[model samples]
Target chain A: AVAMPAIAQSMPEVKWRMTSSFPKSLDTIFGAAEVFAKAVSEATDGKFQIQVFAAGELVPGLQALDAVQNGTVEMCHSASYYYVGKDPTYALGTAVPFGLNARMINAWFYHGGGLEVLNEFYKKSGIYMLPGGNTGTQMGGWFRKEIKTVDDIKGLKMRIAGIAGQVLAKLGAVPQQIAGGDIYPALEKGTIDAAEWVGPYDDEKLGFQKVARYYYYPGFWEGCAALNFFFNDAKWNELPPIYRSVLTSAAARANVDMQASYDAKNPGAVKRLVASGAQLRPFPQEVMEACYKAANEIYEEISATNADFKKIYDHMRAFRNDEYLWFQVAEYTYDNFMIRARARG
Target chain B: AVAMPAIAQSMPEVKWRMTSSFPKSLDTIFGAAEVFAKAVSEATDGKFQIQVFAAGELVPGLQALDAVQNGTVEMCHSASYYYVGKDPTYALGTAVPFGLNARMINAWFYHGGGLEVLNEFYKKSGIYMLPGGNTGTQMGGWFRKEIKTVDDIKGLKMRIAGIAGQVLAKLGAVPQQIAGGDIYPALEKGTIDAAEWVGPYDDEKLGFQKVARYYYYPGFWEGCAALNFFFNDAKWNELPPIYRSVLTSAAARANVDMQASYDAKNPGAVKRLVASGAQLRPFPQEVMEACYKAANEIYEEISATNADFKKIYDHMRAFRNDEYLWFQVAEYTYDNFMIRARARG
Candidate 1:
């Protein structure tokens, strides 16, 4: 049925406090706040406003979970997977190696019980959840040297996150949890041999291309990496129905916008990066296979230890399987034909 | 600095005709097409494939002026704005009068501009176009009802395309020409509301939400409008560069996966709309009067003018200067403040 008729509803003047898990330096991601706040205000005709606070303005970027959960801020924009330490299920909310592409992840969230299951998990942390944005398929990692085999990953420190880090750890890569802004310096200063930012567009802007000559590909870990917007459960429930809807809609829009920005900007940026002498390399196939092997093993381990993680992962895997099975025949056949023909032509 | 990606530059094979005026739908817009296509091919390991079509697939939609100007696309996904009558610019796109709601317009395009813009415009004379999708914006048709008095609209159909038919004749409304969407529609749709569309998210989606909407003050011209992909240009650049980008990108994404798709499956679609409807709405007292007045004068003149409605009435006057000037301030003020605040926060 439709929402309450406009006449039947008496809108409320609500003020919201949002704590971001990021500094405002990153506009594409931080742009979410600008769009969301502006949208919330416009939707409410300025009657409802969400005063957004930057990561450090309220708390440490990493502390957004506690702040939002504790109601220090009514909401937050972050990578849920970053909190895998608290609940491995969060990785499914974001992405894990070999997971669905950004588009598939969104579909899963909207159609595959992803939002529902992820929300349930957020409730435990005292918040409500929405997928705000995604970094479409990420690059593997920025490396100091060419990776010839799985052995190349041994003991190398990397500023990485999500399940991919663990997968890398199994392959002997020392994973470090660092923020985006911090990655370049850490890498440039030699604190880490490699790091993985997003694709060419962002990587070039961050100047990762300047320092790292051997950039690897197939960010298998994140075909589509999602950013999450977390609203405190209590605060969320307090929103006027319209306000809630606005937040949801805005988040979804921002989700697409973020990725689109990346796509449009990436092509031009890649052209520039190449012009600037960046050396792009593919992750060794063996390394990819090994990472895949390690990833499954880690997924299994987390599932065994955490029921919540196992529960969601099981569902996600099932859907992936069903989806993959269907794609094999129709889409796969045609896309294969097109790619080859286009090249040949 | 660059991906100079040689490994995966491994272009897959395939050929096909796809006409669209959209970027790859990222999880929201055209994301599904991507997921579907990727699943198919990736599942097979380059065995089969489907190509895509983006705007300018073969030719450009607006060039229906150009297509008839040349001969393009077998099919397309475009909104009326691109052509604007071939001459009046009235046919420029679709959905004038308080325009169509995003959903209803979808109904219309599949049903209205659906056949109108194409057969009525693109395909009718020759080429083909279809209603691919829409994002719901449709503020108070923007000329707004708030005019100080009706006399204000003398000779003003305002650049408003499509529905200008009713108002322009009724008042001095003059329609103008502009395009966005690589000619999928007008990237220029924003300031016209003399209106805009999609939603704040997509408005902001297309970067218009930031420019006007009186913050949603008015814009009855386009309530919910559709976007189409135009096609056929010299047998489509003879099926290469553009045709290639399109067939591959469009078949898999574009209009079919655009804002409409996002609006449809977007879980919190309405939620986000309300959140960012952007203080938008019906025009004020005098403003609408001025629009009516101006729209009529322009309509009368055009009704009697050249075989093709000489001198397309470019923009809504009374409020035109005021609106543009208003935006210069609002945009600058709002943008600078927001940008700075975001930076600080």
Candidate 2:
């Protein structure tokens, strides 16, 4: 049963701290961490609070996973996908090419049992998990020039996240991992020909369109990139059950807020990007098809080698299949009808 | 800005009869309608889907307030507060007197809210509002509770909801209110003790919970009660939108299944209630003394004017003030430190 104590009032207080891998200026991402921490504090009657710190304050921006992994902090709000350098499997936590969308990922985590399976994997990293946010179906990246074919990907240097970088590498692209704050300078001087951040909201905020005119769609690598709160396993275990529930519930709230933030803010940001000479384009069918094929092959390899990864992947795929079947019949039919009507209107 | 389409996964053509006062359960409330409807349909996807009936299905349950208002069909899941007739305002929602329990209401709404509220209000009338679910904090039923030495009155009937009936009567109390299924019986029932329903959750639900519960608190009226969605609100407004966001969000998922319906299945449902039962008890000697005095003078003047009760009440006090202020600080401190620690352990 869910409990909310009111009027008879008085809630317990909690003080906790968290380190985030993004700057405060990135509202959706960093804002999500802040909101989660604040909600936990308030909801628990301030009995549980998580003080959040921006990247570089607690540790180097890119090393957030390590900080939490080693218990350098009580908790760290960071993207697990960033640590593919340590293990390829880490990328699955954030986003991957041809992966699920934001809503789909949430469904998978909460109801589809992804949380249970993923938590099993997170145990190895010595942290417990809660979804902090999601960058709903990100944009491909800001590119200096258009690519009409798979060959165009060769010799291009791009800053991207996770195994999608590995896929790019396989396609003969050089993948660079850079913290968000530093992406622009590198892109400006041709240090990198392309960089994939999140969607229009964050991309516009980072001034990415100003540097790269050709903006691509379907960030294949991050169909729905999700961020997470990595609680030091020991600290998580020590928390009273209520606090833990608060933490989890708070994460769910942040997850919803992050998606809404992007959805709400992106419509305008996208317009601004287009007005500012950013050429928004869908990846050519050939490119998308090739990438999908490559993704499948890569997935097969990972499944064979990693037992845990295989387990989660199999379960996720099965649920997705069922969901797709239902969605195709209902959501698709309704969406199609509405879109057509909307267009006519 | 959050929008969910009205139609969900299509149903296998079937028939169902759902009774609710709400126009198809509007999100939080409608979620329940959808859950029940969908579950039944899904469980027997091809065969049945209990057709939903909104307020006034047989007769405006609020007016027809059910004890099986109009000899309605099968089920009704709503808050107890809507019907304050057989008793009074306190009987309408759940309980008054510092009441609002997630699980207890789940029990009451499903068991008590439905059984007691419907039975108390409609036993002679023969209509019912099953306990499908509850909206957590119903405004103190617009009250008429009064006090002078906390002993000035002993048999004043009221339109009330839930167990608060027992509590209020304990403090010089008769409580009553009609069921949404058989509300007219109650408004017409001189047998009323007092009535108290929901606030906004109240307004949208039994309409009467809003219309009547208002007629007291801080003393004997509902301090906090869950508003319910009694059916027979005219077979529930056709049910398409109700099935999607409105009813699904309300009934099945209102505030995360509330503390009702599912509470019994919960493992430790009763422990916290018992430990906290003491807290649930009436205002202490000093507190009741001051409040009782204030309530009387306020009630007399409000009745005397027959003018704006809200306006007069507004001048008397803030919606949530001094007592609440203390809660944010010290009360929260004690709760977080000792109370919470003990509750969980």
- For each candidate, the alpha-carbon lDDT, in order, equals 0.54, 0.54
- lDDT, model 2, position B270: 18
- TM-score of chain B only, all predictions? 0.47, 0.40
Binned by DockQ into CAPRI classes (incorrect, acceptable, medium, high), candidate 1 is incorrect
Q: Model 1 segments beyond 4 Å from truth?
A: A1-9, A328-345, B1-345
Per-residue CA lDDT of model 2 for B1-345, tens digit only, reads 733321122222346455655545444454556555654443222234566566566445454245335535544545454453444432434543333233223333332223443444443344433345443323333323333345644676665544445455556666564554454345445345344433333233344432233322222333334545455433443443313322322232332333222221111211232233211122234434433344445445444654333332232222122223212221122222222222333
Candidate 1 residue-wise lDDT, A15-73, digit = tens: 77887877666667787667667655653345567888888887888888788887777
Q: lDDT tens digits, residues A1-345, model 2?
A: 734423111223446668888887787799988877766654433445678989888797678878877777788888878776776666667766666555456657754577788888889878788777776666788999999999999999999756787788878899997878789999999999999887777788888888899988767676577899888898888866545645665665566556545554565577687888888776776676667667778889999998877887777666544444323321222222223322343
Per-prediction TM-score = 0.53, 0.53
Q: After superposition, how far is residue A159 of candidate 2 from its true place, in Å?
A: 1.8
